[model samples]
Target chain A: MSSTRSGGRSAIVRARVLAAASDLVTTKGPQNVTIPEIAQRAGVAASSLYRRWGDVGALLLEMAAERLAQKFPLPDEGSIEGDLRCWTEKIVLGLNSTEEPIFFRILLAAGDVAPEKRIKALAPRREQLQAMLERGRARGERTPTVEDLVDHLLAPLYMRALVGLPVNEALAKHLVERLLNTPP
Target chain B: MSSTRSGGRSAIVRARVLAAASDLVTTKGPQNVTIPEIAQRAGVAASSLYRRWGDVGALLLEMAAERLAQKFPLPDEGSIEGDLRCWTEKIVLGLNSTEEPIFFRILLAAGDVAPEKRIKALAPRREQLQAMLERGRARGERTPTVEDLVDHLLAPLYMRALVGLPVNEALAKHLVERLLNTPP
Candidate 1:
C-alpha cells in the first residue's frame, strides 16, 4: 500500500509537470519557456525538475516525444504507402502544433546533442516506424529500409520545418509517394 | 586613392577576422569559440564583429559559408548523377572537417532562423545546384526539381548529420543513385 501510494504520487507529479510545460509552451512559444517557470507552474520544486530533466531542452524533448507519440500513433493500415502517408500527414500536423516545432534546435544548440542523446530522443519513434515497416515486410511487400524512410520521408518533413517551409498533407502525401515509388 | 585604400584596408581586416575565427573554431570547436576570442586572436575589437555579424552564431555562419564554398566548389561533371555524386561526396567530406558540422544548430538555437536568413545562407549553393539541373534538362534527361533534390539529396545528408549518423562517400554515392533512379 505504501509503495503504491508513492508510485501514484510520482505519476501525479509527472503529469502536472508535463501539463505545465504544455501550457507555457503554447502561450509563450518553446524557446522562452524555462525550467523555473515549468516548476512553479507545476507546483513542484525546481530542484526536483532539474534533477530529472537536467535542462529546459531535455524536459521539452521528453514532453515532445510523449505528446507526439500519444497524440498521433501510427496506424497499420495494410500498406506501407497508406501507413506512411498517414504517419507523414500526422507528423506535418504535429510539427505545426504550438509546442512541437520543436526542441530539436534547443537540444542541438545545447551541444550538437551527443550521439547517445540523439539516439535516446529518437529511439521511440524509430521503433514504431520500424514495426510499421516490419509489418509491410511480413506482408511480403518490397519495403524500403528505415534509413530510406528517414532520408526520403521524415528528413524532408523535419528539414522543411527547420527551414520554415510549408508542411501540408499534400506535401506529406507526395513524400510518401516518392518513398514508395523510388527504387532500391 | 582614399577609397581604394579603404577598400584594401577592409579586405585585410575581413581576412584576418575570418582566419582567426577559423583557427579558434578548429582548436576549440564551433560552439565554444566566442566573438571575444576571435576578436582578440585577429587583433580586432569585439565591437567591430558585433557590428557586423550580431552574435557568435552569425559570425560562425558567415565563416562556414565562405569556407565551405571556397574549399569545395561543385563540379559540372556533365551529367546530373556524376555532378550530384561529386557534390555529395565533397559535402560528406566537408561535414567531417574540423568546424563545419556547422553553425546550423547555433543559428536555429538562436531562433527558428527566419526563412530569409535560411535562404540567404543557402542561396549560393542553391544557385549552383539549379544551374546543374538546368544542364540536365538541356541534355534531355528527366531532371528532378530543385525541391526534389533538396528533399531527396540535401535533406537526407544534413538530417543524417543532424542525427549523428556517419556520413561518408559510399553513402553519398548511394544517395545520388537513389535521387537519380527515383521518378518525379
Candidate 2:
C-alpha cells in the first residue's frame, strides 16, 4: 500500500503503455490509434491510462519524447563534425523510417498543453546538441550554436520529411557539410 | 447541368467551405472541429462535403493549401534580399498568428493520402520561391537555392513555431540574412 512499494510496478506499467502507444502510432498511424487500443495492447487498464496521461496526445508526446532520447542518443565520435554528422544521420533515418510522419506529426501536433510538454520533448535533444558543440570547442574547433543546428541540420530534414519530400543520407551529409563549413 | 455553370457555382462552394474550415480550425482546435461542423458552418450538406473532401484530413489539407495561397502571396520588392526578407517576415507573422499551432498542425498531420496532396499543398509555394530567386539571379544578386530558402528560412521558423518556440520578426530577419549571406 506504500507509494514507494508500488514504484517498481508503476514503472513497468508506464514502459508497457509507452511501448504499446509507440507501436500503434508508428504502425497503425496516430489517427488510427486510441487509448483503449493502447491499453488493450499493453495489457493495462484503459482507466489507468486515462488517469495518467489524460489523452492520446499527451501519451504520444511522452512516448515520442522518450523514443527521441532513447533511439537517438548523441554519438560520441571524436570530432564534432563526426559526432554531429552521425547524430544527424541517425535522426534522418529515424524520421524517414517506420516512424516517418508519425514521429513528426506527434511533435508538430501539440496544442495548449504542448508548449510545456513540447519543451519537455525537445529540451533534452537541445542539451545533447549543446554538449556536442562544447566538445568541439574544447577540441580547438569552432562549433555553431544549437539554434544553428536546428536551422541548418535538423530543421531541413524534419521539414522535408514532414512535407513528404525526399530525405536521405545524401541530404543529411549535405546539411552537415553546410552547417560545419559556414562560418560562425 | 452544364459544367461551366456548375464550375462557377462549385468555385463559390469551395471558397465558402475553405473559409468556414479555416475559421473553425483556428477557433476550435483541429481535433475538436469536424467535417460535419465545417459543412454546417459553410451551409453545405455534410454528405457533399464528404463526397468532395473524402475525410477530415483531406479537407484540412485542401483548406490549409488554399489558405496558404490566398493568405501568403509572395512579395516583390525588386531585390532578392528585400523580397525574401519581406516574405519571411510575413510567414513568421502568419505562423505566429491565430493560426499558430493549427496552420502548423494541419501541415504536419498528413498521412497516406498526403504526398501527392502534400506536394499540391507546397509546390506552388516552391515555384513562387524559385521565381523570386530567378528574379534575383536576373539582377545578378547571387541567390540560394529553393532548398536553401526552405532549410534556412522557412524550416527553422516552421520547426520552432511547430514545436511551440518563440518565432518573431527578429528571428525571421536573422534567417533571411543567413540564407542570403551563405555562399554557393
Candidate 3:
C-alpha cells in the first residue's frame, strides 16, 4: 500500500482501539478492564495497542479528554442565564445519558489517582468554560468568579453525577437561577 | 474462653480488621487492596476476614458508612448560618485530610457501580443533615428542600473532595452564605 494509505489505516486502527476501550469502560468498570481485553475487542494486535497508547490508563485518559471535549460545547445563548441554562442542561443530560455515568466515574477515579493527569485532562474544558464566562462578563452579565462557578455550578452537577441523583432540566434551570440571582 | 470473653474478642477482631482495611484503602487505592492483605495487616486469620465480611466490597461499604457517620455530626449552634459554617468547616477539613480523598473516591466509584449500596451508605448522613435543616426551619430560617440541600450544599463539597479541589473554611462559609441568602 502507498504511504498515504498506510497513514489512513493507522488512524483507523487508533480510532477502533479508542472506541473499543470506551465501550469496555462503559460496560465494565475501569478497574475491571484490561489491555488484552481492549485489544481483543478492537481487533488490534497487542503490540500495536502498546505502541500507540503505552497502557490502558493512558488510553483511558485520552478517551476521557475526547469524551469531555465532545460533551461540553461552548454555549452562546446571548445572555448569561440563557447560556448557563443551555450549558448546565447539556451537562445534566450528559450525566444522565446511559453508559455516560460509568465512563465519567472511571475518568473521575483516574483523576483522583493521578493529579497531574487530571489537570492536563481538564485544562482545555476549564478554558472553554472560562472563555464562555469572559464573554458573558463582556456582555455586562453578572458572571461569577471561577471559584464560585466551580462551587455553585460545576460541583453540584458533579456531586449529583457521582451520587446517582437525577440531573433533570429543571434542576439545571434552578441551578442557573440560583447562581444568577444570588449576590456575591 | 467464656462466651462473654469470646464476644469481646470477636468485637476486637472486627475493629482491628476494619482499621486495617481503612489503612490499606488509604495507602493503596481501593482497587489494589485484597482481603488477605487486610487480614494480615490486622493480624487476623484469612478465614475470619472472609467469614465476617465475605468480600472486599462489603468491607469497603461498611468502612464508608462508618467514615461518613464520624465525619458529619449534626451541628446546632443556635442559628442556621453558624450551624452550617460549623458543619461545612468540618466537611472541608475531612476533604482536605490527607488520604481521605482516595478513600472517598473508592466509595464514590462503588456508589456509581452499585446504587443500592450508595443509598444505604448515605441515608443516615442525609438524615442528619435533614434533621439539622428542620431544626433551623423551626427556628424560622428559610430551610431549603432536601433536594436543594443536596444541590447547594452537599454536591459542592463532594465535588471538591472527588476532584482534589481545595475545600477550605472560606469555601464552606461562602457556600453557606449563598445557600442562606438565595431564595428557594
Candidate 4:
C-alpha cells in the first residue's frame, strides 16, 4: 500500500513537471529551457525532477513523447491513401507549424543525441506508426513492412524539418502521391 | 596564389582533425572522448579545435560524413535490388562492427546542437543513394521518388543503428527487396 501510494505521487509529480516543461518549450525555444527552471515552474523540487528523469535528456525525451502523442494522432480515414495522407499531413503540419517548430526541433535535437536516447525516444513513435500500419493492412491497403512504410512516408518530413526549409502542402501531397502510387 | 595556399592549409587541417577524431572514436567510445583530447591527439591547439570545429558535435558531424563517404561505392550489381542489398549490407556490416556504433552515437549527439548539421551530415550518403537510384531508373528499373527510395532503404538501417540493435544481412536484404518492389 505504501509503495502504491508512493508510485501514485510520483506519477502525479511527473505529469505536473511534464506539463510545465511543455509550456516552457512552447513559450521559449527548447534550447532555452532548463531542468531547474522546469522544476521551479512545476512547483516540484529539483531533486525530485532529477530522481524521476535520471537526466535532462531523459526528461526531455519523456516530454517530447508526450507532446508528440498529443499533437499527432492517427485518424482512421478508412482508405490506405487517405489514412496515409492524413498521417502525412499531420506530421508535416507539426513540423511546419510556427508554434510547434520548437517542439519538433527539440524532438529532432533529442533524436540527434546518443544512440540510446535516440532509440528510446524513437521507439514510441515507431510503435505507434506500426500500429497504424497494421490497421491499414487489416483494411487491405497492401502496405509494405511497417518499418519501411513509416520511414518512407515520414523520412522526407524529418529531412525537410531538420533542413529548416519550407514544407508546404504541395510537398506533402507529392510525398503522399509517391507513397500511394509506389508499386508494391 | 596566397588564397589557394590558405584554402589548402585549411582543408589539410580539417582533414587531420577529422582523422584524429575518427581514430579516437574507433578506439574510445563517443561519450569518453573530449574536444581538447581530440586536439591533443591531432597536434593542433585546443583553441584551433574550437575555432575550426566549434565543438565535438561539429567535429563528429564532419567525421561521420567523411567516414560514411568511404563506406560505399555501392556496385554495378545490374539490378536495383542487387545493388541495394549490397549497399545496405555494407552499412549493416559497419553498424554491426564494434566501433561504428559509437561513431553514429556521436553523430546523433551532434545533431542536437545543430539540427541543420543532421541534414548536412547525411547529405553525402543521401546523394550517393540518390545517384544509385537514378542509375537504376535509367537502367529501366521502375523506382518511385529517388528520395523516398533512399529513405525507405536506409532509414531502417539508421533506425536500427540508433536503437542499438543489430541489422543483419537478412534484414538488409528484406529492406532492399521491399524498397525495390515498391513503386513510387
Candidate 5:
C-alpha cells in the first residue's frame, strides 16, 4: 500500500498545509499564491499535495469553509437584538482579526469571482440568524418577519464592516447601536 | 523611434484592452486575467502595454476608477431623498446589469485587499452624497451629520444589491421613503 500517513500524522500534515496556504494568502494575496509554493512550505511533494486535494481551488474553498466555520458562532442570546449584536460583533471581530485577514480578503476575492459559492456559503449563517429571530418572535421581543430585520438592520452593519474600514471594537459597538435603534 | 500608434487607433486599442479586461474579469474571474492575455486580446504588444502602465495593479486600479466615474452620476435633484433614491436605483441597476457585474464584484474584491486604496477610490462617490446631504441640512431637511443617513439608508441598499440575491425595487423605494420621513 502507499505510505499511509494516517491518524495523527495525517492531521498534523493537513494543518501544516492549511497554515502554509493561509499564510501565503495573507502575505501575497490569494490570486498570487501558487500550489508549488504551498507544497514547499508544507514540506510535501507537490504531487502528493495534489493527490490529497484535486486542485488549489478545491483546497482554498475548503480552507475558506473552515475559516468561516471558525468565525461564525451559534447565536444563543435570548433577545433578537442581543443575538444580532452578538452575531455582528463576532463577524466584525473576525474581519479585523490579524490572523484571518488574508483568509477573509481571499474569500471576498473569491466571492467576486463566483457569487454562487458566496450565496451557498452564507446559508448556514443565515439559517443560524433566522433561528434566533424565530425564537425572539416566539418570545415577543422581535418582529415576525426576520427577513425585514435582515434587510434593514443587518445589511448596513455588514457593508460598513466589510467595505469601509477595519472593524474595530468601537465600530462594532456603534454598528450594533445603530442597528438596534433604526426605525421600522 | 518605436512605432507609436496614434489618436483613433490608440483609442480603439485602449477600448479593446478595457473590453478584454472586463470580459476576462466576468468570465474567468479577475484574478485569472493576466496582463499578457489582455495585451494579446487588445492586439497590442506586451512591451507597449508595459511601457504605458508599470504593472497589472496600476491597470486594475485605473479600470476601477474609470468604472466608478462612469457609474456614479452627478446628483442635483435638490432633495436628499430624491437624490438618494436616484443614486440607489442607479447603483443597483448598475450592479444587476449583465454587462457590468464584474465591475461591482471587482470593486468589492479590491475593497478587501487594498482597503486604503479602496477607501480613497470610493471617496468621490461619498463626497457627492455628503455634498447633497449638506444641502439638505442647510434646507432643514436633514441632521447636521450625513453619516447617520449613510449608515441607515444608503449602506443597506448597497449591501442588498451586492450580496447575491436581487434587491427588491419596492424595498429600495421604501428605504428611501423611510429615510425621508425619519427624524434625526
Candidate 6:
C-alpha cells in the first residue's frame, strides 16, 4: 500500500511540474522561463526539479514531447486526401499557436544540445504519426512513407514556423493536394 | 582616391572577419565561438567587431547568410526531374556537411533570440530559391511555389538536420520524383 501511495505521489508530482512548465512557457515565453520559477509554481523543491530534469532544456523537451503526442489526433476522414487535409490543418493550427513557436524553438535548441535525449523524447510523437500513417495504409489508402510525411507534411509547417512565415489553411490544402496528386 | 582605398580596406576586413568566424565555427563549434575570439582571429578590434556585426549571434547570422548564398547552385540538367534531383542531392550533401549543422543550430537559436534579424539574414537565400523556381517556370516546367519548395525541399533537409534523421541521396531522389510526378 505504501509503495502504491509513493507511486501515485510521484505521478502527481510529475504532472504538476509539467503543468507548471507549460504555464510558464505560455506566460513568459520559453526563453524566459526558468527551473526555479517552474519549481516554485509547481510547489516542488528546486532539487526535485533538477533531479527529475537536469535543466530547463530537458524539462522543455519533456514538455514538448508530451504536447506533440497529445496534439495530433488521428483523423478518421474516409478518403486519404480528406485525412491528410484534416491532419495538415490541425498541424498548421498547432504550429501557429502563440506559445507553440517558442516551445518548438526551445525543443530545436534542445535537439542541438542533447540530440539523443531529444530523439528519445520525441519517440512517442513519432510513433503516433507512424501509427496514423499505418492506419491509412491499412485502409488501402496510398499513404506516403514516414520520411515523406516528415518531408512533405511536417517540414513545411516547421520551416514556416522557424522562418516566421504564415502557416495558413491554404498551405495545408496545397500540401495535401500535392501529396495526393489531386488537382488544386 | 582615399575613399576608394578605404572601401577596398573595408571589403578586405569583411572577408577576413567572415573567414575567421567560419574557421572558428568549424573548429570550436558555433556555440563555443565568441565575438572577441573572432575579432582577435581576424586581427580587428573588439569595438570594430561590435560596430560591424553587433554580437556573436549577429556575426553567425551574417556567416550563415553568406554560406547559404553560396551553397545552393541551381542545376540545369535538361529535364525538370534531372534538375530537381541534382539540386536536392546538392542540398542534402550541404546539410550533411559537418560544419553546416552546427551553423544551422546556431542560426535557429539566434532566430529564437532575435527573430527579425534572423529573418532578414535569411532573405537572400529565399530570393535565390525563388529565382531558381521562376527560372524553372520560365523554362515551361511545373515548378512548385516558393512555399512548396520550403515545404517539400528545404523543410525535410532542415528537419533531418535538426532531428538527427538520415538525409541521403535516396531521400533526395524520392522528393524530386514525388514533386515532378516522374516514375521512381
The sequence of per-residue lDDT tens digits that candidate 4 reaches over residues A132-154 is 77887898777766545545666
lDDT of 5 by residue, A1-184 (tens): 3355567688888889888987887778777777799999889888977887656755665566566656655677777667766766766666666554554455555543344545554555557667777787789773435455456555655565544545555665665555456566
Ranking by lDDT: 2, 1, 6, 3, 4, 5
Model 4 residue B71 CA deviation (Å) reads 5.3
Put down candidate 6 lDDT per residue, A1-184, tens digits, no spaces: 9999999999999999999998888887676788899999999999988887777888887887888678646687776677778888878877766544655676665643455666666678778778877787888877776666777778888787777677789988877666666321
Best by TM-score: 2
Off by over 4 Å in 4: A1-10, A17-59, A76-80, A97-149, A160-168, A181-184, B1-10, B17-60, B71-79, B96-149, B160-168
Give the distance in Å from residue A163's predicted Cα in candidate 2 to where it truly belongs: 2.3
CA deviation > 4 Å runs, candidate 5 = A1-71, A101-121, A143-154, A161-163, B1-59, B111-114, B143-150
Question: What is model 4's interface RMSD?
Answer: 5.3
lDDT of 2 by residue, B11-92 (tens): 9999999889889888886666788999999999999988986778778877776666666778889999899889888887
Binned by DockQ into CAPRI classes (incorrect, acceptable, medium, high), candidate 6 is: acceptable
DockQ: which is higher, 2 or 6? 2
- Runs off by more than 4 Å, candidate 1: A1-64, A76-78, A96-100, A135-142, B1-67, B96-100, B134-142
Compare candidates 3 and 5 on lDDT and give the better one.
3
Q: What value of lDDT does candidate 5 attain over all alpha carbons?
A: 0.64
Model 3 residue runs over 4 Å out of place are A1-29, A32-63, A70-72, A111-117, B1-29, B32-63, B70-72, B111-117
Error of 6 at B81 (Å): 4.1
Candidate 6 regions off by >4 Å? A1-59, A70-87, A90-100, A112-119, A127-147, A164-166, A182-184, B1-10, B16-59, B68-83, B90-100, B112-120, B123-148, B182-184
C-alpha lDDT (0 to 100) for residue A157 of candidate 5: 56
DockQ of 5: 0.28
Taking all chains together, the TM-score of candidate 4 against the true structure is 0.64
Q: Whole-model lDDT, candidate 3?
A: 0.73
Colliding residue pairs in candidate 2: none
**Candidate 1 whole-model C-alpha lDDT, 0 to 1:** 0.75
Instruction: Please give, for residues A76-143, the per-residue lDDT of candidate 1 as tens digits.
Output: 99998889878888788777776545545444443434555565766766788889999999999999
